[model samples]
Every structure is written in structure tokens, then in C-alpha cells.
Target chain A: MQIVVDLTRCQGYAQCVFLSPDVFQLHGQEGLLYAPSVPEDQVQRVRQAVAACPVQAILAGEEVAAGGG
Target chain B: MAGELRDGRIVVVGASLAGLRAAETLREEGFTGSLTVVGDEPYPPYDRPPLSKQVLIGGVPADTTGLPTRRDPDADWRLGVAATGLDLLERRVLLADGESLPYDRVLIATGTRARPWPDAGEAALDGVFTLRTRDDASGLAERLDAGPGRVLVIGAGFTGSEIASACRERGLDVTVAERGPAPLVGALGGTLSQLAAVMHRGHGVDLRCGVTVTALLGDGNERFVGADLSDGTRVEADVCVVALGAVRNVEWLADSGLAAGARGIACDAGCRAFNMYGIVTDDVFVAGDVSRFPHPLFGYQMLSLEHWGNAVAQAEVAAHNMINPGPLQRPHLAVPTFWSTQFGLNIKSVGVPTYSDHVVIAQGSLEARRLAVVYGYRGRVTAAVTVDMAKSLDYYRHLIETAAPFPPPPGAADRAIAADVPIPSDVPDPKGLSHEPVVALTGHLPDRRLMVVQPTR
Candidate 1:
């Protein structure tokens, strides 16, 4: 599964980072860096991160490909 | 069990973050029965954290801050109507519109509202405002844009501090009056609030601490012009924001037979609410700022959290427990986490900071303003707060969850953990502060003295 974070809407709350640290990391206070492609073992964690995001800035699965397009 | 749970009329009260998320989770968990969401406000669910930050900063319009739904929950939306009462016996929700909706299971997420000034007439003054709803933010945003002579913020809590930050950024003179010893003392404790006080002063805010607003001195025409403080000083301002914090919307549940009051509705770890007689109800659940659920991490204390993450996590847990059978149901054990951005600082905290008795600067220096303060209670890590050092918070959260020893061991921080002595956290009693604390440590007195009684066996 692939994921994309809406950088424009990301307020750097870091809920995703806390849930799925392998996929998302906060560079500084507000700069967020994340892996777009989720590892097979990390898919469930990524899904939880997606729902746990306070701003709902995360998108996964086919929605990521569609959003990128 | 799956077949038995597939269909049921589930009714969700409150259409804000918790309510919306619960509805979505119910559908996602495959509960295909009738779903109805009832809200007191006319607008649908919207994100509120931005209302005090970006909206006040004029970066986004308040009305445009609606939350994006994961998918259509296909639920009946009941907007602009308050849930007047809950008939637990008949399993019906009584609305203020004189209509009753039946439900097989009900989720109460009525959240909270801003506590207005005690004086109703003074609160009705033209320039007085409270930031809670979208309408409140929009109106305050417009007033700030008009360039008021001075803005008098009556509370130095998160909302009040953010408002002062916005005013200073917008080049408007502002004065903050806090009843505590320093800004954020009631929430983050006295140690870090000193830094907050410095930041406020450093930003040219007329910071006045240890004083309360005696009276809002409105002009003869009922327009706010200034305020008198307890220190025998008056501040002249064109606008005033009463950031005195929130009051739970549990008034409607007065006769509902639930154990709800000023501290919010009491619930078990599974989000199942209890009655006044302390009996847990299987069909009824509670979530969001309106919930007071016991957390094992905090000594099974009932923690009432007003954080965004908790609202989402608890709502999902409540929805899952509503649909699944007993054995398959899970507890809402997610540690309470919240973040605040103000005065160019990103403050993030995990676990209940107020639950701790001591705090140590485990990483970085206080002067640098980038450090992680780990809180401990009875030799175990209870919570941690990071000011601009948010990356290390998750590690502390692990320590808290595992009940790691206080003054955390080495390698938790990027550098070797400093052998700093833990100091008293100096968390003031909530009763002494004017603003409502973000996390209320209600009904859990770990330090209370208990007598040992011996009886003949």
C-alpha cells in the first residue's frame, strides 16, 4: 500500500509519526518527512495512522495514486 | 456474533469531531443499520484546533475549516438541534425540536462549550468574545483585522495565549491577565510556564500574571473599552476575549440518570458510561471532551482530556465496542496526546502531564527552549512534554506506557541522558486557576491518606 500526506494541511501534529514511525518522521518542529510507499509489515500501522491523524491529512491505497495524479 | 452485530439502529449525539469519527467507524466496522448523528450547531463537523491558531492568525477562513470525511457514513444527519434528554429505559434520544429518535445503541459525544463570563450582561458587551465555535472564531478574526487599539485577553491558557500571539503578529497591542503565577502554569505546570511568560514578554505582550480581571469595564453604550484587574490597574482595549475555558455540555444529561456533571460523564475503559448508581450501561457510550474514562497508566484515574487525538481514538474504540461482541471488544488505552502551536513554538505532550508529581529536563537545556521534560510519579514515568523537540516524545510515551522508572534511563534522548535531579512539578490546584485545564485529574487521589483498620478474623 502507498500513502500520501497533504503537506498543505499537515500542521505537524505528529500523530502519524507516533503511530507508524517507520513511515512518517517529523524533521524539525513543523517539517514532516514520510515514506510514500508502505512496507508490507507496516500496512496495518499506516491504516491506523491514517485514521488517527487529527487533520485527516493522510491518504492511502488507490487514493494515493489518484491524489498524485 | 458477526451476523448478530451487522444490523442495529445506532444514534450518535453531537456532530463535532468525536461524533463524526464515531459514525465513520461504525460504518467501517460493518454496522449497516440505521445511523443518525445529532448536533446542536447548524454546521457539520469541523476541525477546532485551527480555530484558535491559524484562523486567528488570518491564514484560513473559519467557515472553510470543515473536516474531510473518510467516506460517506450514509447516516441521517440531524443538525442545529440539541439533544434535550436521554431516555435510557426506552432507548430514545429526546431532541429540543420535540422529536424522539429510537436507537439500539447510543454514543454521547456532546463535547463542550466555552465558559462565558459569569456576568451575563458583561459577556453580552459588543467587544467581549469567547473562542469556541466557528462563528466565534470568524467574528474574532474580523475584529482583529479591523485593528483594535488594544486587545485584552482575560485568560492565559492555550486559547488566550494563541489569541495574544495572533494580536502581536498582526501588530496590535495586547495585554494578557492570568490568575495563575505565570502563563500556562495550570496546564504545563510552573516550571515550563516561566519560559512561556518569557516568550510572551519577548513578543511584546503586556503580560500580567497572578492577577484576575476584576471587571470588564464597558463603555456606557455597552461597548467594551477596558478592564479592571485585581492588581488595581486598568487596561484600555477595544476588544476583549474571555478565554476562561470550557464547560461540559452535560446539562442535557441532568435527568438522564448518567453519572455526569461539571467533570464530564464517567465511563469505563471501554467507553461504556456508568449510571448515577455506578452501574455500567452496555447500550450507552461516551467519548471526546465530554468523557471521563479511567486509564490504567494514570493509576486507573478518570482523566477528562480535551485533546483532538483522544476524541478520534476514543470515538473509534466506542464504535468498535458498540458493534463487536464482549470478547472481541478492545479497550481505549491510547495515551492522551495533544499539540499546541503558538509564539513560534510547537509544544507536544503525551500521557497525562498533570498526573505526575515531579519533572526532570531529561534532554537539552531550558534556556534553549528545545527540551523534553519527563514527568514522574512514585518513581515511574507518567508523562512527557516537548517544546520544539517533538521527535523524542514517542520514546517517552513508550516509557510512560511501560511504567518505566523515573529520571528515565540512558539513550532515551539523542545525547546521553543528563543526571539531572527531578524537581517538584509545582502543578497548581485547578480550583485556584481561572481557566479550565486541558487535562483534568478528577477523582484519582493517589497521595490521599488511607487508614488501615484491623478487624478480628
Candidate 2:
């Protein structure tokens, strides 16, 4: 599974960090630094993180099928 | 019905505190269907109350002010986009990005934006600021931390007074200029406002009343340096904060055909949005600062409240009605309540004090800076304002709800002066003392139209 976050929409509420610390982290004072992709085993955590975000800035989905390549 | 039934989608515009809370309540009420929330700001929903207080004082970081949610409603959030229009017949919300989201029901919680200085270029100056969003608070906090020599705050509304209070608390020199006869004249009437002026001056605020800022002067580098008052007084300051009240976020609804304008999105008692022709739509609802709903207690006068408590309560009511049937639904009739902490004073108000014609001291004394002023109209208790005596406000709120008599039942301890001692004074207009009250009695209607209509000959 892959998680995508629009940086501009992130307010550093840290709810994502609270839900999935390994996937999302706060960087500096205002920036929200987070991993864009996660392993299948951690997909649930990523989903929880997306759900917990107050601004709803995080999104998780299946990786694009590897057929085009 | 016990399981997740696939009901039609519910779309909430504004993604504000009220909108988000309503969405959560819909799920809690077992409305299992698609949900979409749209917000103009890029960021997700966050708390706004702190932006004016703790955020400005740097006690709480701006970005970290997001409100804690009990549970997450997994729904599509359309951020960085705005709802441009509403098609009631088609049941679709037109987005600025050209995408239209269909909904079985829609909620409008497009709150309000901070009123900016009249001069666009002058307001754009580096040192000129208005506190509303997280970005605004963060930027202003940063400026305050830089130790500006002097801070000039225009208008003594709650936001303006709080900003001045924050500056003074930081040991910085500050000045507050109010066009009204006194600070908070719009909300608390003139007598209490006079007390506010005294408090501000006692705290070294250099309070200036009955004057207007004609022009904002800028330094050679284009940063706000001073302000020219209408009375020919040029006050030098490194920074200026404009707190001219708020402008309801209803412009996008202009073309939506809904009766949305500067006041707000007009709605019926059931929270259903009304059209230009005064027709109400069931599928569409409005809550929070964006909603102008009629209150039965205030003689069915349509009130547009910007209070925090009203937003939460109205959102919950809007949410329940969105999912439940009509019989089980209820009106959002919670008495309007708001509190402000400034200059070491905790000011709380219940009901619409400005909507009343008379005010009397129900408890404590104004001289001691601890009192509750009960407002009345035609002998019925209309509203109450408390300064450092908030506990008594709850009782007065009940009095207002029950339409208790003016000069209400005597204080509990019998400490108050004769009931007639605290006579009602004229509620001054925000524009100036010469004008009438800003919150006028529109007479048993949701819109100002009915109040203005003259009877046929």
C-alpha cells in the first residue's frame, strides 16, 4: 500500500503521528515530514493515520499495478 | 438498519469545526453512506479559538491547535478547494476546481473570515496583521517575539482587545484605538465598555476612544510604521493589528441562489438553507457562524452568532437531523454563549444582550469589576453579560430561556442594590456612538427583509 500526503494541507496536528508514528513525523517547527509509502503489514496503521488527521490531508491506497512498466 | 445501510451521500461544505463535528455525528447516528467535506484552506480542520489567545501568546504552537476527535469518520476530504455554488434542484455542490459533488443532503458551515483593514495596500504592509487563521497567529506571534518597539491595535473588539492583552502580557508597549465611544461597545453596550476602557488604561494601554484610523503610514521599506487618526493624531508604532470584526464567508453562495450574503446564510429553524425567494430546502442545512437562524426566545428574531459554543451545538443538531427522521429531529436552540479573557478579566455573555433595550445589574457591582448585567426588552429578560462573575451567568441564561422578567428576580445573596438601581443604557452602534445598535430587532423573522417591510395602505 502507498500513502500520499499533500504537504500544504498538513497542519502538524500530530494526530497522524499519534496514529502511526513510524509513517508520519513532524519536522522543524511547521513542516510535517512523513513517509509516502508503507509495507502491507503497516497499511492498517497508515489508514488509521489518514483517519486521525484533523485536516484529512493523508491518503492511502493500493500501489499501482505493475503492468505499465 | 442496524448494519451499515448504503444511504445517499452527505456533503459538508467548509470543513470547519462545525462541519467536521457534524460529519462525525452523522456517523455516530448510524448514517452509513458516502461523505465528502470540502474546505478552501489547504490544511485539514483545526481549532480556531486558540489562534487569538494561546497561539498569539506563543503558549501553544499554531500548527498543533487541531481539536482532538473521539473517532475518525473515514470520508473524502477535498482540501485546497472551495464550494463555488449550490444547485438545490440538482442536489450538487459546484467546486472551484470544476468538480461537482452530488449529495442527498448538504451542510453549510462556511464560518467567517477576519475583517481586514480598508486600505488593501496598507494592510499588505509587513507589520500590519489580522489574527484569524493559524498562519495569521503564527506570523503575528513571530513578529511579537521579535520585540517590536510599539504595537498599535485598531478596534477594541474581542479579537483586538485580546491581541492588545497578549502584547501587554509580553511586556511590550501597546495602544488600542476604538472608533466607538468605548471598547467592546458593539458587544457589551456602552456602560460595560466604559469599564473595559478603564481596565485597558489602568494596564497602560494608551487607550484612544471616539477616533478612527484615517490612514496607515508606512516606512520607506514599505512596512507599517504609524497610523494617522481622524483627529489629526499620528501615533508611531512598529506594528499594527486590524480587528474590525468578521465578514461571514458567504460570498461563494452568491451565485448558488441561496439567500447568502454579508450577514450569513439564512436558514429556517430546522437548519435548512433558504433560497432567494424565501423557499427552504430540506437537503441543504447550515450551522455555525454561517447560519442565521431565528430564536424563539428573542421574539423569534433571526440571530447570526459567531460564538464557539453555538457552532458546536448547532453542528450536532444539524448532524442528528441529517440522519434521523423529522419527528426525532430537533432545533438548535441553545442559548448563545461566548467568553473572552483579556487584561486579566474573564468576560462571559449569554443570550443576545445587544438585542435588548434595557440592562440591569443582576449580581455584584460594576464598580468592583465583577458583575452580571441582565438585559431586557419590553420587560422580558433578553440577555446577560458577566465580568469575572461567570457562575451567575448560567442562572441568568436560564432566566433568558424562560423569558424571565427584566430587573430579574433579585440576586441570591440579596447583595445587589435596588432592582432599579442598574438602569438600562443605550446599546451603541459599532459604526459610531451616534448610530443605533448593530444587532437590531428584525421582528419575528429570519431575514432583515420582513423587519423592513411596511404595511400596505
Candidate 3:
């Protein structure tokens, strides 16, 4: 699965860093750093990270259709 | 468990972030029931934090801030329709258009609205603005782009400070007038507010603390010309932004008999809405910025949080409880977290910082404008606020969740010494605050319940 963070939309809230440390890490007063793709073991956490983002800046795997249950 | 979970009409009010997330989570939890989302606003759910940040600084257009759903909830969205009243006995939601939505279960996530200036005449001025919805951001952004002579922000809370930061970032002269002793004193306490004051001054912002803006002056064109401060000074500014705070959208429930008031909709830890007499309702729930639920970590004192993290976390738990039977229901007890960016500093917080008596610098140095201040009530750590330090928040959140000792331990920090001396947190009374305390304590008095904590050993 691929992980993507929109650089422009990111506000450096770092909720993702707390939720999924293995996949995402935030530096001192800086934007987060993370792996572009996730292994099978890390996919669950990467997905959680996406939902945890305050701005919805993170996208994991294929982007879900806007407005799907 | 009473009965098997089955398909039923699930109605969610307020199509904002919390409402949208709860709807999405309902489906994720395998609820094949009919779902309907109702919102007074014409547009679908959109991000709000940006309305004060990048949108104000012109980084992105306000219209493009719609929150992308991970999966569509396939809800029958009732947009631009306000829910007038809710009938608990009939299990129906009365709409403004004379329609009623019948629901087996309902989630009230009616969030909050930007608290407006009390005076209608002053608020009607052309240059006055309050950031809450997409249209508000668009209108305010247009003024910011015009490079007004001076921008005046009335409030030094997070929202107010962010607006001032955006103005400074855009190279527009800005003045911040706050009623508190210092910027962010209502939220992060005295010490961090000092750092925030320094940061704002460093950015060439004219910040006035411990003073209130008594009146807004107009230039006769019905445009904001200046503001009269209580300290006997007048600020000449063309644009005035009111970042006072948010008021919970609970007026619709006035006759609903739910325990909702200015504080917020009162709910149990399980997210079930309580009646006026404090009886918990089964089918009705509340989440997001509008719900006030007592947190166990803070002596079960009820809290109403406006943080983005709290909204998402509370929504998931509320959604889960909606599906499960009573015994199987999980409580919404996630540790509160919030972050803000302003004046080139990244401020992050975990736990309820305002729920404390003393604060100790746990890491880094306040003089350097980089540190984590641990908040304690008595002797146990209650909350922590970190400036320009995001990584340390996880550690502090753990300490808060576990109810660790005050001053915290030294091992978590990279610095040689964690400032362990306890100083008064200096969190002001909610009544004296110009803005609503984002994390509000509604039940019980703080002085009586929030007695000081000393070391357990």
C-alpha cells in the first residue's frame, strides 16, 4: 500500500506520529517524515494514521471515492 | 446484550467533521441500516482548522477545503436544512422545512458556531469577521489579500493568536488585544502564555494583554475603523477579526429536554445524551465539540473539547456504542490532544492543561522558546503543553493517561535536566475569560474537586 501526505494541506499537527510511529515520525518543529509504501504488517496502522490526520492530509493505498459506506 | 444489532434508520445531525466521521464509522462497523445526514449549511462537510491558518494566509482557497471521505457513508444528505426540534418520545427530528426524520437511533454532533460579538451594530460593520464556515474564511481571506492598513484581533486564545500570526506572516501590521493576563493564559496557563507573548512580539505584533476591547469604532461607512480598549488606548485598524471562541450549537434542543446549555450537550462517558433531569437516553448520542462528558482522569469532571483530535476520537467511540448493546459499549476515554502553528512555533498539547494547579518545565528551556510544561493538580500530572516540540507529546500523553506523578520522570527527555520545580499554572476562571475555555469543566466546582495532588510515595 502507498502512503501519501499532501504537503500543502499538512499543518504539522502530528497526531499521525502518535498513532503510527513505525510508519510516520515527526521531527522537531517540522513536518512529518514517513515511508512512501507500507508492508503488509504496517498497513493497518498507516490507515489509522490517515484517519487521525486533523486536516485529512494523509491518503493510504487507493484514495476512497469522495461522498462511498 | 438486549437484542441483535439490526438494520434501522440512523439519523446524524450536523454534517461537520464529527458527524461525517461518525456516519462513516457506522458503516464501517457493518450497520446496514438506512443513514441520513442533516446539516444547516449548504455544502458538505469541510475542514475548519484551515479557515484560520493557510486560508487566512492565502495558501489555499477556502472552497477547496472539503474533507475527503475514506469511504462514502451512502447517506441521504439533507443539506441546508436546519433541525428545529427533536422529539425524544416520538424518536423524530423536526426540520425547518416542516419535515420530520424518523430514526431508530440518532447522533447529535451539532458541533459549534463562532461566538459573535454581542453588539449587532458593531458586528454588522463591513470589516468585522468571524472565522467558522467556508464562506467566512473566503470573505476574511479576501480582506487579508487586500493588505488592509492594520488588522485587530480581539482575543489571545489559539484562534485569535493564529489570526494575528497569519496577518504578521502576510506582512500586514497587526494588533492583538486580549482580556487575559497574557496570550493563551486561558488555555496553556501563565508560563507558556509568556512564551506566546514573546513569540508574538518577536514577529512585530502589537500585543496588549490584561485588557479588553470595550467597543468597536466605525468610520461612518459601516466599516470597522478602530477599537477602544479598556486600558484607555485606541487601536487604529481597518479590519477586525473576532476570535472570541465558539458556542455549542444546542439551541435546537432547548425544548428537547436534553441536558444541553451554553456549556454543551451533557453526555455520559459512553456518549449517550442526558436529559435535563440527568437521565441518560438510550437511542440518542452526542459527539464532537458539542458533547460534555466527564473524564475519569480528571476526577470525572465533565469536559467539552474543541480539538480536532477529540472530535475524531469521540466520534469513533460514539459510533461504536451506537451499534453495541449496553454492556458491550465502550466509553469515549481517549486522551485529549490538540496542536497549533503560529509565529513560526509548533505548539502541541496532550491532556487537559487547564485542569491543573501547578506547571513544571519538563523538557527543554522556556527561555529558548522550546519546552514541554507538565501540568499537575496537587501532585499527579494532569496535562502537558509543548512549544516547538511535537515528539515529546506522545510521552506526555502517556503520563497523563496513566496518571503519573507531578513533574514527570526525567528519562523521557533528551535534555540533561527536566525543570521539576512546581509553579502555579495560572489558569484563569472560565467566567473571566474573554473566550470559552476550549476544554470546559461544566460539572462541580474546580476549587472543591480539583484539590492539589502531592507525591504518592
Better of 1 and 2 by DockQ: 1
User: Per-prediction fnat values?
Assistant: 0.04, 0.00, 0.08
Off by over 4 Å in 1: A1-69, B412-419, B444-457
The predicted structure with the larger TM-score, 2 or 3, is: 3
Residue-wise lDDT of candidate 1 within B35-125, one digit each (tens)? 8999998887776876887678775678756665676678788888899999999999999999999999999999999999999998999
Question: Interface RMSD (Å), each candidate?
Answer: 9.6, 13.9, 7.1
Tell me the deviation in Å of residue A16 in model 1.
13
Output the lDDT of residue B199, model 1. 87
DockQ of each: 0.08, 0.03, 0.12
* Residues A14-46, model 3: lDDT tens digits: 888888887676534654545544568988887
Interface RMSD of 2: 13.9
Candidate 3 lDDT over residue span B218-285, tens digit each: 98889899999998999999899998999999988888988888889999999999988789999999
DockQ measured for candidate 2: 0.03
Itemize residue pairs with steric clashes in candidate 2: A55-B44, A55-B45, B359-B424
RMSD of 1: 7.8
The weakest ten consecutive residues by lDDT in model 2 chain B span B433-442
Model 3 chain B weakest lDDT span, ten residues long:
B448-457
Error of 1 at B320 (Å): 0.2
TM-score of each: 0.87, 0.82, 0.87
